[model samples]
Target: MFRGTGFGTYYYDVRQVEACDTSFVAQNLSPLECSSQNALSLNHVNSNYVVAMNHSQLKLDMSKYCGKRVIVTVNGEQSNLPLFIGDGCQRCAGGSASSDVWNAVAAPGLDFSYSVLEELSGGAACADGHIQIAWEIVDDTIYNFSDGVNFETAPAEASEERTTSSAALVMSTSLSAASFLHTPVNDDPVQNAVAVLARQGYGDATEASSNNALPTDGLLASLAEPR
Candidate 1:
């Protein structure tokens, strides 16, 4: 417990294995400030996280966890906010290593108390939430492999309409072959071939045959190969 010279002002702290809790008292103190006279400014608590309150609003600091993902709850309400390190809250002195919690109280305006909980173990562990730093750090692998092909060939027939004549074909068949050797090869030709074939012999039939005989396979085969 810390006492101030004024009538009713003091600071108290409770310690836990994973957390530190602090409380403050303010009596006959107007515009009470923890970090400074301005309530907008964040206090420099020893810990990575800090919470301060003024007559009008509450201020918090969790910036120490920047680059290190974390989540916080205030008065039992989870923030559910992006706990992006360095971005949210204010950076305190000595980082999160200093004090897990710190508090100060001021009054003569109103009486209130605040409770905060910070869980470092549950949030994303890295700057980019995409990768789990724990898994990556533990593995310490020097190399990674992906199943795909890489093209290393010069354009032999760079045709825009035909894939077989494009650089991708040369890479897939030759340079990229080494990577996809185990994968089954694609047997079907490119779409350009099908389009070219569709144009052949189209609209060539006489009106009588076109109207009477359907263009079904049977009719087409009968016309081409007479029985």
Candidate 2:
């Protein structure tokens, strides 16, 4: 779910990846909100890329979003490329925003003619590189947005921004499965570190799911593969 101060919310969903000849196939993308009006279904040729957009007119200097998952379409093509969302308003920070959030990712056969940036800014200087998206836990209620999506109040400049413990900004990008598995373990230093970071961002410290927590399967997928 995407949120803004006065604007209403929108939902988005992504398709899953399927095994292809050499790599994975990315199928059609879906917007969660699209279903509200019409049961929007996507048509694609070859599954290749997933997409994301920023709809907030507010400035956005988002965190790195490589290797993350965006929307979810069960039993469909899925891509692991992470997407970085920004302000939809070009006049705003990075020229990314909410209008972008409505349109779905570029699927093989889908037509993503409508763009939030294009709608708001009349056009956009499209960013280069495959986007990496972060996925929210299936059922966990993590709110940090102005509507309590991430928090009651919005972050200064970044959508996911908030004060961070020194360690959070410096924690290793790489982590052992042990880090996630150790959640129920004693109040060890690493666990404590994760806890503080979660809270600093207005997340629940005692919640089993951490908003800061991301899917490690992608990382592990790379590591688990034969060398």
Candidate 3:
């Protein structure tokens, strides 16, 4: 079980991860390279509360939650949501959720997925493009990934009222992931430069050079030139 108060945002229409695409960023590259690999699709998943968290923050063995259900609580409202890992180092406090979960707590605004801002503000505007939320993964189970791929739908009446009480190992931590428009930029120039290189499919900068030196001025100058 993972629990903490952090930030939350809603996302939709992100059915697949793409090469070098900012949306649905993942720490692992294997998922992005394989066409069949994907985050839980809203249409395919049985529940409406699927979410993706920052891999770095969660730091759990992927095998534990890859295809399992976790009980997620927000604002005293609880739901069993499918969990996945999103971008690692870019996000710190907030992770992304499906739009259905967002609609339950706040008003609808933009048709496209970004970050939850005014939609979650309850008519009040928020400058951060995010809403502070208390959320927790109260329970999780070991599940077969193959079986989970073909999800089952629960009865409509049970959707909102569903609850889980299974005993699970309790682990506490905050979750986070970046949104397309509102990803917080790092202040350190070297970190920023490394991030730019990583975004361009240059492989993980943290593991790139044997000596781990800051990117040279020549390399930074080259990045400024038009591709």
In terms of lDDT, which candidate is strongest?
3
Error of 3 at 7 (Å): 0.4
For residues 78-153, write the lDDT of model 2, one tens digit per residue: 3232222311321222323323332234211111222321222223313321122223312222221222122212
lDDT (tens digit, per residue) of candidate 3 on 1-227: 55555555544324433322344333222231111345434434432234445444444454443434444344566533344322222244233433323332332211112322233444333243445555544334433344444233434335544432121211111112233223435775556776766665666766745575445546765765666
Better of 1 and 3 by TM-score: 3
In model 2, which regions exceed 4 Å deviation? Answer: 1-47, 57-59, 64-67, 73-227
**Lowest summed lDDT over 10 consecutive residues: which window, candidate 2?**
4-13
Q: In candidate 2, how many clashes are counted?
A: 40
- 1 or 2, greater by TM-score: 1
**Each prediction's whole-model lDDT (CA):** 0.26, 0.28, 0.40
Model 1 CA lDDT for position 158 = 40
Candidate 1 per-residue C-alpha lDDT over 35-71 given as tens digits, one digit per residue, 9 for 90 to 100: 2332221121212222221222222422222123223
In candidate 3 the C-alpha lDDT for residue 157 amounts to 33
Query: What lDDT score is found at residue 185 in candidate 3?
Result: 58
